[model samples]
Target: MKIACSIHACSLSCSNLQHGGQRLLSFPLSKQRLDQSNLRTMPKRKLSQSKILGCSRNPQSAVGAPRAKNLKTGQAEEKGIGKFRFWTDARRFKGSEEKCIVQKALYEAGGVRIGGYPKASPIPGPLGFQRPEDWDFLWAPARLALKALPARPGQLVSACPGMMSLTRKRQLSMTLKGSLGEDLAFSIIPRTFSLPDELEAFKKYLEKQRSAKQVKNGSAAEEEAAGRCKELAVGNSAAASDRNDLWILKTAQHLGKGLKLVTADEAVREAAKRRLKSKKAKPYVQAQQYVANPLLIQDRKFGIRVWVLVTGLNPYRVYLHCNGLVLFSTHQYSSETWRTEEGEVALGHVTNYAQNMDGMVWDLKMLEDHLGKDAFDTLWCRIARNTAMVFSSALPQITLAHEALSVQPESTFELLGLDYLVDDQLHPWLLEVNGTPSLAVEHEDLKVEAIISKQKNEMVSDMVKTLNLASRFEPRYTSLRLAATKTKSLAAISIEGSEVEEGRSEHTAVNVMSDAADGQTTSSDPQEDEEADIAGVVQNSSMDVSTDGEVSGAAVASKNSTRQHEIRDAAEHNFTEESALHVVSGGSSKTVQTVISPADRIDHLRRQLREEMAPTTDKVVWFRVRQELQQLGGFQPLMPMFPMKSKSDQNVSGHNMPWKDRDNELVSMLGKTARLNKRAAIAAEKKP
Candidate 1:
């Protein structure tokens, strides 16, 4: 049986009673909202691997050349923003599989979101990592997507496992190693969360005067030379991203939520003490890259909670979820703002949703009312770029980690929460990435968390349907489920581990896709019911197969815009020669030099799903999103692409950015030919 519980928002009984230690801060328990329904949980799990043997390539850089006079993003006299254009599918097949394509493999970074008795064998730790059930979860920021993503349905596959390790998030390979290395495969994954020592070292790197003289050797210099960031700071004019200094000062760090702000001089000693109190023997409060002059909500500080789904590494496949929550601070923001007698800025200064739920708004309704659609979107794109940067930095480490552990590509996935804070100038600063973000929706603001929880449920549900984890995914043959099993019905199981209606029609399954839905399915025809178990014999080409499993008329012509996972191209997708890889799976994922004949992969997908879909073309119809994307709000369904490319492929033709990112760029690129460009120019000239 499935249960859906809603919690009413309760006022907090929290106060900054103490500074550090377990008494750092305390909250009296509000009445629990769950009764027969106490706490609700979003069902999810994961799988993933990495590559390091020259296999990890740098993240694909944004294609647009830096505009000379683009909108300034930094707090200081507005440094130039790296306004990149969007990238089109390098190659999309002209006549593709939009017909037999069941759905995109839409998973959150990587994991299984369906809750219950795990259908697969249990791993020692969460997602195969060495984490204990009662493991001390260090505090971290929860991130959410600031942009809309392409969404579809199959079964369930999530990107960020509830517990995340940037190492797993940035893996660069999908292939498993075959030979046993001389000793063992050496693995090293980079840390997404920083320790006190790393923070100190980073600070030194930022303070140029000492950075150049800190007795740093060639290796240190080389490490610094690798990709990183521009400058930024809390002081509106100070360089935030470029600097080595931390703008945040915590009197102590042991206090997870009880963290106190400190000055530069007191930071080092307090951090040391905080590290000592760490159960894992590490510092929990490291210097956060300061977001100066942050964009505020109703004069109160806030942060965005975005979710990113990463399916594989090497060819890093990323899916940014469209819907997310905007959290606000309790107190109004002001540079001159501080507490009584003490120069401390409490929750108001920080945008943590958990910290400042009192009187804070949920919908970005406040921000939108203030900045309007154009400004908010531009800010979101900047956040997306910063997010990509974070992944790019960790790519190499993740690749190596995967190689060392011999992780299989399709076997693992991760769902990560990406937190971001945009400055007043609309410049976004990276906060911290959380490994396991709380999926429970019973925080102080119950009403808001409940809404967010519901959205998450829907997002995960669609994702499950697309991945076929509910019915088809077999843990043993993880990667080639489609290739391994030609005839099997996942309809027997749902993500929540509930029994699915044994003989339901494909159309019947859609209505009951929710966790609360009883897995009951119905069919109009009895003959079709008998054939459900026997996957219609898959021929070399789906175009040749009819609804009754016989040869049909010529295949319907498909449009070229169908999009699939960045790393995975399965189910309903048309892969051009560039996208399809020839695989010879015999206990190994060996990608042959040549491409897999399109007929084989696409046909295989058709055969497996034949039992699950309707004969009508509606089974593979596209969804439209121009306002709020239950998936990208403004995206056309035909364009399976996010960050859609420019229709005119001119050198000067700017890449079509996700709607928000494209607003300003649209004017810059198409302004000349656009009739509205003159009005835009006049408006620009009018600005002082």
Candidate 2:
């Protein structure tokens, strides 16, 4: 059922477009020639002369030179260049717009030589085209119609399986509440109940509220009759009696389509009637507590549109766009106004850009300017924490879905649009998760359109960099492939032992240097000398060593080095006693029982993956990708808060960071994985 087609580069309509008077190069695109596996083995061919260098042409340059051109500047760039292809099933997107945007993005960020979907001739039966697996990258709708284009291993996908569970209103509400417990879920998101299914529970909630109200009113009346109530307190009692009874009813199937506010009593009555009259028991609507006291600007309510990229599951890797859009409602907001029909006409409560033609929006920087620096920082911290928690809660289901699909976790990624409504307390409440948030903007205002376009472009570019879709930067993919194909699988093997050895090597080198400085000869072990020589070379590359044989560098690095030497010396000295390390002791000599912190465990894992398993590890790949992202003029990472800690725990050891807000679940999962991998690696290393 899988068809593989070869798309020739010469067939592209835009192939001859003028690029700074120098024509952009196009490869054969023949599957055998362009496929990554065959790229190195393919026969070399001469490249034609460019218009820019028409005076002289060198056929030899075509064989070894990088010829990929930048999509924006049309200049030949040597950095991160590779031959990659992209395809789009634009049925669900804005057809031509989706194709154009993706094609350009793939050429620029993907490092694809020629970016375009293969044109179908007057042919039948899949148009004699390639299967989804053939393409380097795919852009499909959020529906995830796998049957139409079955998900295959090795192919990069736009959507993740089982994403609808988080995207749908009822499912998301039920999942979050079930996984995180009602208390935490209700605090993060509004208390939500799926209709029909949770009708009895809703009724009980209403009944409890009514009973409490009746008791309060009766007590007040009794106090008044007994002459215990003061005349001035009557107004205060009446004011206190008013409750937040407003609830929003949203269609489970559609978002921003049929949203309306209803009172608790009215909702209960409707639920009761639906339970009695309905033949089917399917959940059609969800009742959520409306956020009446929303954080507003210019007296208008707004909701933040967060763009989150989920690149992994289990220990999920999330990168949040720090500069997400802040969508503002066109009309001024007031809880009292929403109660009237005229207020509903003004659409003062809704902040969805699609619903309002003249919607006002601001990127995070603009919002930061509106709110002072200190206030913005505080607000952003909470938002980041809440967003991480939401994903952590959904980790179980996402993992199951990923397993069911039988695809590599690294091969799949999902871009989610997480909306949040901030209360007056600046606490952001989760609104809804979008599996395939739209990138296209249809705003009439040119300024708004320009802002959205810039943000979208930057986000998409960063996503490309993060995923490493380009062939040359395929370390993550290559490591995974090697692990998959090996008979003795090296999957998830920890390199902690290597790291521990490295530390010891550094300690030995420092000792040797100190002894030499004191005019003393140290041990003449070849390994020790080799390590010391390597360390000296690295240090000398950055800065000069002192004339008196003293090491000198930046104050911070010098201080950290001193701390490392002290810790290493102490660990060695203290753990030498057999009784102190009796549990891990084996064979003749007592073993050193140094605590492998979470950071050390992760570092070991990354190193082991690179040295033992493949040339580069996922961590190394992510680190490089992060560097690319930081250089961009857009959002920054929000998860994996302390990436540098994995390299050296000393980097963030003394900061008073909010430890309570850390993703403990992810950290725990990583630690467990590292331990298991370490055991496996040690066993393998011991094999004769």
- Best-fitting candidate, scored by TM-score: 2
Residue ranges of candidate 2 with Cα displaced over 4 Å = 1-82, 94-102, 110-130, 145-153, 219-243, 253-255, 272-283, 339-346, 472-688
Quantify all predictions' global Cα lDDT against the true fold.
0.34, 0.51
Per-candidate count of clashing residue pairs (backbone under 3 Å) = 78, 1
- Candidate 1 wrong stretches, greater than 4 Å: 1-194, 199-246, 249-258, 272-275, 278-285, 337-345, 364-366, 443-454, 465-688
**lDDT of each residue in 2-111, candidate 2, tens digit only:** 11221322111112123333322222222122222232332322111112111111111112223566668877754223344444554345524433455556666533
What is the C-alpha lDDT profile of model 1 across 375-433, one tens digit per residue?
97887666565454444434444555555544433333455666666666776554545
Q: After superposition, how far is residue 153 of candidate 2 from its true place, in Å?
A: 4.6
Question: Cα miss at 336, model 1 (Å)?
Answer: 3.1
Worst 10 residues of 1 by lDDT: 130-139
RMSD for each model, in Å, please?
A: 22.1, 18.2
